[model samples]
Target: MYLLGLGLVLSLLKYLEVGPVAAWSWWWVLSPFAITALWWAWADATGYTKRKAMEKMDQRKQDRINKHKEALGIQPRKPR
Candidate 1:
């Protein structure tokens, strides 16, 4: 995400002819986007994206359960 943002900012700066970025080659200016694409591809291939999504879903599920437990006067489990 940070790489994607950096790519966008650099592209804009290059487009507007701002600072030293304007003098840089298009390849250099556009490298971050390529890097971001590679990063996503690697993450997807390694299942890192799926794992993170599942972790987030688990957290939400736990939070919901805790909220219900609290409403029922049960103490929520402590986080590890």
Candidate 2:
């Protein structure tokens, strides 16, 4: 909704032949959408959006510790 209103205002300014205001306003309008889309794409590629990916990493680390404890015949400590 904000984007739509900004685009409308920019268009109106362009139609009115307003000099630098139109260009500056349009730049402000476009930069955020462009930056956010890029960030979302990067995050998607890196698996940052998935809880399962984080859980899997934690489980792998826990398994390594558990294996070391079992080899030493030591009981695992409970989480505080």
Top TM-score model:
1
TM-score of each: 0.91, 0.37
- Maximum-lDDT candidate: 1
How far is each candidate from the true structure, as Cα RMSD in Å? 1.2, 10.1
What digit string (tens of lDDT, one per residue) describes model 1 on residues 1-80?
99999999999999999999999999999999999999999999999999999999999999999999999999998998
Candidate 2 stretches greater than 4 Å from native: 1-23, 52-80
TM-score for predicted model 1 compared with the true structure: 0.91
> Which clashing pairs does model 1 show?
none
Runs in model 1 lying further than 4 Å from the true structure: none
lDDT of 2 by residue, 2-80 (tens): 5455656666676675877556656664565566677668778888778667889998999899889989999988767
